[model samples]
Target: MIVSLAISGYRSLRNLILPLGRLTVVTGANGSGKSSLYRSIRLLADVAQGRAISSLAREGGLTSTLWAGPEIISRAMKQGEVPVQGGARRSSVSLKLGFADEDYGYAIDLGLPQSDSTSYFNYDPEIKVESLWAGEALSRHNQIAGRSGPSVKVLDSHGHRVPVLQTLASFDSMMTHAADPKDALELLVMRERMRSWRFYDHLRTDREAPARVPRIGTRTPVLSSDGADLAAALRTIQEIGDPVQLEEAIDDAFPGARIEITVTDGLFEVLMHQSGLLRPLRASELSDGTLRYLLLIAVLLTPRPPPLLVLNEPETSLHPRLLDPLARLVTQTAERTQIILVTHAQTLASQLSGCEGCLHFELRKELGETVVDGVEPPRWAWPKR
Candidate 1:
């Protein structure tokens, strides 16, 4: 249940704070920074997995992803009286990201590493500061733990600063290295919760897609990112999950169509049975749109829902008629888990915007920075480096 998300110095998201709800739909035109926002959330998830540095490296390092705009977009620049340009440094180069739930908040600061002649990874970004605080807003008094440079400290039960680590690696996150279950139980809890957040980007439904191939079956409570276990996941839903909802979702999209799984030896494959068909169609025989719709159904109806689920442009390849059914599925899934849907389709966005506990954000570029139209950002404060 993240209440707010704050990102700064990341691509077009230069100093952006967004409020979240049980179901948050983010939509905007092309080049409006929707993809940047999606990648930023994935980067935050990488931190909890101790792969933040490598993730950034794969994206061409901190310099490539850092905001390209000036430190300040002055009134003169906005008025077209002056061009946007960088000025002398007012603060250190830092890329910050954070999120706050109902009871706690966490933030991390990354900056350029100090120059070193002997180090090959000198250009790697360093974790400058990390903070975990109580409540929705971060303040001095609510901070439970703070990590500065290579040192980590946490507040004990009696509210005294207790040293946790003396030399944490610059690439490793405190969420992974300093979250001791004994001394820093809050860190451990937060770390695990962050790890539980699931992300599903564009699912492949091509001829050779993994979801179309038969795979060994298991009682899958969650669908894999590649949807390799689509059959097992659907079978799991039929056996232990909400079978009624599963059938309804399938029928909603393809009127009289239902799903069946056949097992040969240990391999399971998905089959579709539709009205007025001589026989069921194999996964490989299904159309791209149909297969994608089934994949979405499997994902949204997961038996073991994650704390947070993010879907990036899920409406891709889906027919306009299927958007309503997909929206209905998302609305139902939001009841059990927090969902953030990044989409460009106004039809899909319109269908879910009116639902209860849903927040809609239409992002637009203003002077090369992404801004939410007609919405004030929630209260957020980044930890000073």
Candidate 2:
């Protein structure tokens, strides 16, 4: 479970630290940086998978995503006494993202690459610093493993400094390249846990959406991010997972509606059995909202839950009346996994906040920066470049 999350110089999320709970609901107005926060978390997960540089590149490079505000927002600037402007930069160009979990913490820093005349991928960001530490907060004594540019260091079992990698690549993460099992035991463990972080953002439910079309069957313990294997996943849950919860979730949302899977020649198709209907409706015939609700159920009640589950705007096509059921489903799912729900629906936020062991945050923009409402931000220290 992540106890805290910190982001700096990422879109409107300049210098933001947020506390997390078993079920964390983050809500805000449009352009209040909710999507930016979600993207930042995905970027942190990408780092552990050795895809951080490529992920940033796909987002149009670091320069495009970095904070465009002045390096420092002065008090006068907030009061409109002085116009916002950038002068000399007091710190290095860095976009930092990190989180502190139950027993460990991890942070990574990305910066513009040095002028590389020989490489065509000059716009790619360079990994400047990375750190893995013990406890909820990082400190000098708790620093277990870290990377400074190309040099990677780890604390051995006897607490002696051990050099793991001498010439790590600029675009590669130490989590992937230097996490030796023997020398960097903690680093390896942290990397695997980070890899288990799952994200579901706006699953496609349109007529041509993959989830609506029939696909080959497979033993799917976990639903795909695109929900292409929705039938197999639901079937897996019905067989090995908690079928009672599955049936209850469906009925809770659609009253007497239940789900059925039909497999023919290895192709799996989803069928719905609802009250007051002679014939069942196929996935392709269901409304967009209904399909999306089923996708959410398949994800939240998985037989094999990830260490972390992030849902972005799950209330997208859901009706207002269904928000309460969705909220209840999410809260129930939190018993087995940590969840972070980014949404724009006030009703859903309110419903989630009413749940036990849930944290609610309303984000607002202050001087063009995203700030959590009426809460003191967590204390954070970034690893120096």
Q: Which prediction has the highest lDDT against the true structure?
A: 1
Prediction 2 global C-alpha lDDT: 0.92
Which is the leading candidate under TM-score?
1
Q: Compute each candidate's TM-score over C-alphas.
A: 0.99, 0.98
Per-residue CA lDDT of model 2 for 220-276, tens digit only, reads 989999999999999999999999999999999999999999999999999999999
lDDT of 1 by residue, 76-149 (tens): 99899999887898999999999999988999999999998999999899999999999998997999999999
lDDT of each: 0.93, 0.92
What candidate 1 gets wrong by more than 4 Å, as runs, is none
Task: Write down the lDDT that model 1 would get.
Answer: 0.93
lDDT of 1 at 43: 92
